[model samples]
Target: MARAPGFWFRQPGPWSAALAPLGAIYAAGTARRLSRGGRARVGVPVICVGNLNAGGTGKTPTVIALVQRLSDRGIRAHVVSRGHGGTEKGPLRVDPLRHAAARVGDEPRLMAAFGPVWVADDRVTGARAASDTGAQAVILDDGFQDPALAHDLSIVVVDAAKGWGNGRCLPAGPLREPVATGLARADMVLSIGGGHAQRQFAARWPALPVPHLTARLQPLKTGMDWTGLRALAFAGIGHPEKFFATLAREGVEIVRAEALADHQPFSPRLLTRLEGEARMLGAQLVTTEKDAARLPDDFRGKVLTLPARLRFDDPAELDRRLDALFD
Candidate 1:
């Protein structure tokens, strides 16, 4: 949605306690919606890379990784996205040269680089269009709760350290659905983080019903090294801190960190302000690749981008799981 409320991640306090009743209603609504039968099925497998939380939890990279892996197997995989931040209500195929993030959403724009992407408010229509256009498989981007298309496989992606955030729903917490209920429907849970974060995640959920897959985000090796580079890092993703942490891991000297709302629009006024700050700080403006997708053409080159992709800890397991759908 928007920038998640701070109280959602923090220990449950008066705010969460006060909002508990509302959270219950929201949770029940989600359960009732998901429990409904007749979720539309398509000809090809619909693999959803979604999350428990309302906002981002590394779903984009996960989809990118899946698309790349599936391509290696000669599968013509296409992405179907709801186009969160865009105005287009369509099963329109995304052409990076034509469609801006303002039209098709940033995540879909990024995914288009890997494979054919369709931006449709109605996911079923999008998946169908992709299948008709020769897609061997359709990858649903963040439609775990939408239930627009019947998924052959649903992978719930989570931040290893932020395990459901106080274990409540909506205003009371960060979850889109309750942990227990969400996990029961998931075919697999992909935990994204470094070793320490994964360790903490494992300690939290000692035993999961579904297969537990672990992965980490690594720099994409684009030949643009940020090591020892003093830069002002700015991002407008769901969890900007994660991007900042990635930069730190890459050995970038962060002179300043600006965290904006998820899918935040970049206006000329805002760009001017950041430009002034960078000028004064004597540091180059830096941002995540996803955020850079939204930047104006004139300003994009001015901002350095650190692109990353997800690397699964055990690819054999993923391959086995994916192979089953084909079988």
Candidate 2:
């Protein structure tokens, strides 16, 4: 996806006010679509990890964390995705080895690393496929706005630091739907950030109607110490700035930070250019695990990967909801 306009996060200024009329139309269309009937339900429970904002707000990691939590309790969870950036058109299982991000999209490819994943434009079809394939429960990725499949639980994830950007919908701001409208359907709200960011979000939304959950991303242990490591970090995600921040927190000596478009294709030419830049700066190439899924065949092992996993501050409320799904 293209980088969101800067004004989306800013206060209601000329740009936002000028676009407000269009945003109202967009929000109305969303409401009409959501109100449509004939929503389907797969045999198994479907837990949708989605966001109110158009861009990412840690939804991928939230899905990963939920699947991990389900696994700990012996539930087989499968991920069903829309394959946003890929060319795939069917409800097919993703095999990380056989499928490239170019085919199945980066998010689905990365999620497949943890468990079974299905990619299809029609989310309802994908959810059904997951249920038929022994998925005790299915995690519908980024489909809160789509009303085709009825989700047992809906989670709206937000970057605590970037909460509801200007609180407007669509072209006027980052929101896909108005805050109040979306929250009315959401079973929970997850705000991902550090201690300070989390506290600030809570203070800002003290009356957030849904259960508010908080979490922070922590790098998964791979035995490769990141302390003082000299690196040229590049990230192609909805929020590359966050990835750079993660690197800084890990004690990486960032020689240069390159922010690429979300799911930016890694062609050979681009890879060579990035590699040359890293060599000239005497820094190793580093990237996020999501970007690593899109790396070319030869450069896959060469570039360093720092994979972060979401660790919820408290999962008691979350667990209670998950338990309710079975009961």
Candidate 3:
């Protein structure tokens, strides 16, 4: 299991101190590669929405938001993804209703609502599928680290709450690539949450030459009733705490809380264990939409899924950005 940022950042031992040098090396290599142009020559234009971190930074919702915006402008868009946890081979087009989460992965299923969504381990192949489906432009979800596809534009999504965590890579920190590296390649930096991290980034990285936008995490609904109800909350997201926090906000009485690694595939045995625990606690199982997508069909209906959306306060600005992408 990966150690939490609070766990490592609080440690002051020699081992923790020793890792800084290696981090410098990792950061340098990251910067070198990101400095290169991500020029693509595909028949259709490609826009990449990705992040510097390994885990979630609102990229999925951003993809959805962009798809919606593009559609409004008479631009027929499609999405291509790696299908992170789903068990599938070769390139496949996601038919939202027909394809369950187990087949095409959760994000693609969600993206399919806006436009054609295709998944493949081979991104180039997926792009081809999107093209065949009549997509004028393809949105590459989480492809910032993928250098194979030439992206016409790249947008870097950063979690305002966890701003590059200790600014290190892999085992030492949460960054998949260094911040400077991602910023150098990005056409824009989208900061989620109107917090100090976003403000600090603007002050310190003013020379990045990319436009910065502030966004926030919004609940899908105004409220949910959990009065006189016992609940067991579990999630396989970047931060399980965020899910728990949302439950708390909804007034859910969480009798038991469980967390799994990000993008964890659910097994019948695992769901059985959770169901047993829920019964013991006299509670119903509840989870995030992403986690619910990974559950087997037999157990899916038993799980309470809380769907979420990415709502921008000034949605017109985001729409304007998509218009700029095509222009």
List TM-score per model, in order. Answer: 0.97, 0.98, 0.86
- Candidate 2: which stretches are off by over 4 Å? none
Better of 1 and 3 by lDDT: 1
lDDT of 2 by residue, 1-327 (tens): 899999998778999999999999999999999999999989999999999999789999999888999999899999999887899987999999999899999999999989999999999999998898799999989999998999899999999988888988889999889999999999999999999988878887789999998899998888878999999999999899989998888889999999999988998888999999999999999999999999987898779999899998898999999999988
> How high a TM-score does candidate 3 get?
0.86
Candidate 3 ranges with C-alpha deviation above 4 Å: 1-16, 24-39, 96-103, 194-209, 222-228, 315-317
Clashing pairs in 3: none
Better of 2 and 3 by TM-score: 2
- Clashing pairs for model 1 are none
lDDT of 3 by residue, 255-303 (tens): 9889888777677788889999999988999998777766777788888
Sorted by lDDT (best first), the order is 2, 1, 3
lDDT of each: 0.90, 0.92, 0.76
What's model 2's lDDT at 220? Answer: 84
Q: CA shift at 125, candidate 3, in angstroms?
A: 2.4
**Which pairs clash inside model 2?**
none
lDDT value, residue 34 of candidate 3 = 51
